[model samples]
Target: MYERARYWFDNTLARGVTALIGWLAVACLAVVIPVSALLVWTDERAPDTAWAKTAAVWRSVGQTLRLGGEVGSPLRVILSVLLALMALFYVSTIVGLITTAITEELIALRRGHSTVLESGHTVLLGWSDQIFTVVAELVAANANQPRSAIAILADRDVTEMEEELRSEVGDTGRTRVICRNGRPTDPAALTRVSPATADVVLVLPRDHPQEDAEIVKNLLALRTAVDDSRVRTVAVVRDAHCRLAAELAAGPDAVVLEIDDVTARLVAQCVRQPGLSVVYQELLDFAGDEFYVVDAPDQAGRVFAEVLRACPTSSVVGVAGMDGTLRLNPPATSVLSQGDRLVVIAQDDDTTVTTHEPAAFDESVMANRPPAAARPERVLLLGWNRRARHIVRHLSGHVAAGSVLHVVAHGSESLAAEVRAAAQAAPALTVTFGPGDPTLPGTVNEVDLSAHDGVIVLGPDHGPGQASPDDRTLVTLLLLRDRERTSGVPVRVVTEMTDDRNRVLAPAGAGADFIVSGKLVGLLMAQISQNWHLAALFGELLAPQGNAIHLKPAGDYVRPGHRASFATIVEAASRRGECALGYRTRGIARAGNDHEVRINPAKAEVRYWGADDEVIVMAER
Candidate 1:
């Protein structure tokens, strides 16, 4: 009873203060009404006591009422004012209710309970075009597991993200999607995606350069924040140097993929042979013949090539021996022993037991081929860029002693020290520096094309405010083509290209081969969209593990006017302990087409026996 009385007293005091102010206003009006009635009654009096006093009082009251005249219409004005105040009170209450509700929802979002999903979900961190591809693949991978969830963490509105996923990813087969709004770089923000409960954590590259390094930094934050190492981590790195850094950041169990270097290697292979990307697509794609690892029965007398023909929808491309030797296209008639695991290619693992012919062999012709030319003795580097050092480092292992590599570029003064350092470990690769404009005169003349056995054109390094690399390459090719008019000496050329669309700018007559990096990146993206396991398979192939792609003598595979089919070439490679899939045929005039080389018979239709023509093969000792 006391508490209720106190509440009533406080409320009455507040209202009493308001009412007192209202009463003061009303009392002022009482003087005005009486003064007006007196003025009407005393219209006849002038200077008498009653008349003067009445006039004085009337004047004073008139002045007072004029000064404070918000009083005469008391009842109507008070009612109207009360109604206006009540309307304002109701409007304020409605606005307060709406604001409180919105704040509660926002708080719920930050706490993560509003959208936190269950365990066993796949968590994706960061944002990019790669994200769309990754989610599509995850959806496909989760087709067998019902109720699988995919959660994405990005600094974007959740609804906007969901809309994009729906439009770009289409139907996510048996996978539910959850989006959380947060920055990936922040550890606390990462908690919204529930990284500890996730099955796989895919760290994506940022949308710009230095993306891999940024991702590595984010991984470090995640390691400290994500408390669980059992979760498999897969990350895409943009640079080769960052691969080790990312591995360390993501820990030993994490799989850090260096996509740029892999893309460059693929570009190099496709340049060596047209349609090579198509072959890789067929091998790596889920919709086509995929790579599989199957154990073959112990046969002490069987051959590796013959074992390849023994699988269904599967081709034996390689063999893993008991001693861990990975031999691809191993020697024909070479006896396969027990514990040899055949590295076969098939549509899937289920098609590894069908039988087929290994190859039709004629031993006399295979035994008579001569050895390949000595290691590239003199080489020419046509430009300066980041990839130039990598190429030089790789060449160090292959080039023999007494090999000289000349460096020709405008920035030799600045880049000479770096080039010298790269060649420091390789004493055989001596550096000779020359200063000349890549787009101007007297550059190709300085480095005699006829003297060097090989010429490697380094594409322009991408930097702020720099011209396109393709334009510079086209100018260099034109100059080289002009210089080779008199000297018919063979100079094998390999060029780096920044853009695939600009590859057609190079002159076809220069006898130069080119590597288009963009197309290789596109092809990789296309392949991974269908299958995820291919990432590791191609990584092992490009690495120096076992049988890598090598250029071989054309006569070792096929002869001039032999009318040999692709099958015959594959057979010859089987005999030579190499797996041949394609070749560079000479004598074909490459007329206006940039994609294929036309091998015209009349001009130079000899057996493609040159150091320049790289026969696509898997090499084995």
Candidate 2:
């Protein structure tokens, strides 16, 4: 019987607010009535009448419950209690309303539904691993500004994004990082970031099969939400086929970077010129000196050759004409007229000042040696991926006549058409394909490493099992490093990894190069977003038809066993019809040392020259 009554009471209590309120009233009355009766009975001075004492107890209960307690006739006492209960109800309702309103507002804020009112801010839409690199670069780029902000909107928890960003990108200084949660494709949600007034908007692609479609959707959504056409919009697409769609959706003003194309060109370039990756990395990262297009109106009507010696602190690599024609490493006779912008490599925009004083150099230290012969190269490709074919085509453009390329991948036969086309287009390259799994035992040694001038290692294009693409790439990289140790022959190997974190595990040889696709592409997009002119400038730099960056022996320009001023090296490069940007010091190729590449050093700075220390220059090799 007791258990049944307890169960009934528990069930009633669980019936929610009304039941809770009833129980609360009952509990208060139970304690107040007992205490009130006890006080009335134990009082030293009594009312001296039973009816009066009962009335006093009732009045005490009314006082404890905050209802009017009156010692009067029944009708008047009842009216007072009724009025008091009415006032209490009104007060409780107001308190409840205030608390609920405040709670709702806090929830909305936590949901990231508030609109941002700042102008000239950067907005990053979508979430990816590249976001960390991109945000870090943006912070560095805006370090000179007094106040700036980077707003991020993605379909993620607002607190989660903020916590992760704080952990990844610490000490933003005056720059603020704001996060909002919503689908990038939702036009209504886009207003939360106020993209219409944003200085620049970067649409980052996801790591999914439908990433291209997602990018297009985001562009269209941004189009609907952002009516202002002056805002800079930059995005990336992995596949070349989706480039046109992405561009169209982003409108005519947006700059869209193709991942496969950029990675292929970089891999092709790195395999040919070792340490070029480090050079490009320095140029692409905003933490160091990078490409900048600034107007130098005072120095108009000067020839390109004379302009080369104009800047003591910066390097002049190209010029963008007012007519939209960009000339990188233009002819010495080319003139920079009024309204023309100089494309310089410098630490900052304001620091690209040109001095009148001629730079000093020791001309006696110049090497004055003949150029090395361009022999045909035998390149062994250890793996194939979605970018393998494009890499081969780009390799053809840089190699000499009669160059040989043998592809040993798990399914190289499937890439026969691409190999044949690349070979047919260049005629100089003889390409072959054969089936081989790089992860299998004895497979790497079977493809003799000593026979090739350079090796290209491409991660799997797709993950087919428990192991990921980067895992396979790591396995292959381990094999190559082991072979190099046993054979004692340094092999020039360019490795492609999907994730940047895996780079630490790969053995670092002087010739072993890495091109982290996500990070590099993120840096490129960030650069172009900041300045659209860089799109054309980088295109010219990476294009096969024009002069690209190269790393040649320092002995080519300066004699070994002597310290030489950079001005002397610049003069030597000028004589060779090239622009000397910087140099990689000798003995910097061992593991854990990444400070080899230095660009745009002061012309007066002196360095102890070595035959092996390569000079980084923009040249047509």
Candidate 2 at 2: error in angstroms?
A: 9.7
Q: Give the range of the ten consecutive residues with the poorest summed lDDT in model 1.
A: 597-606
| C-alpha TM-scores of all predictions | 0.62, 0.88
Q: What is candidate 1's CA lDDT for residue 455?
A: 71
lDDT of 1: 0.62
Inter-residue clash pairs, candidate 2: none
After superposition, which runs of candidate 2 have C-alpha atoms over 4 Å from their true positions?
1-10, 26-84, 411-427, 462-468, 589-591
RMSD of each: 13.8, 3.5
What would the per-residue lDDT of candidate 1 be over residues 266-381, giving only the tens digit for each residue? 54344333445535544443444555556776444687555544443345666666765565566677777777766655645555664444434343333236656666477777
* Model 1: per-residue Cα lDDT at residue 454: 65
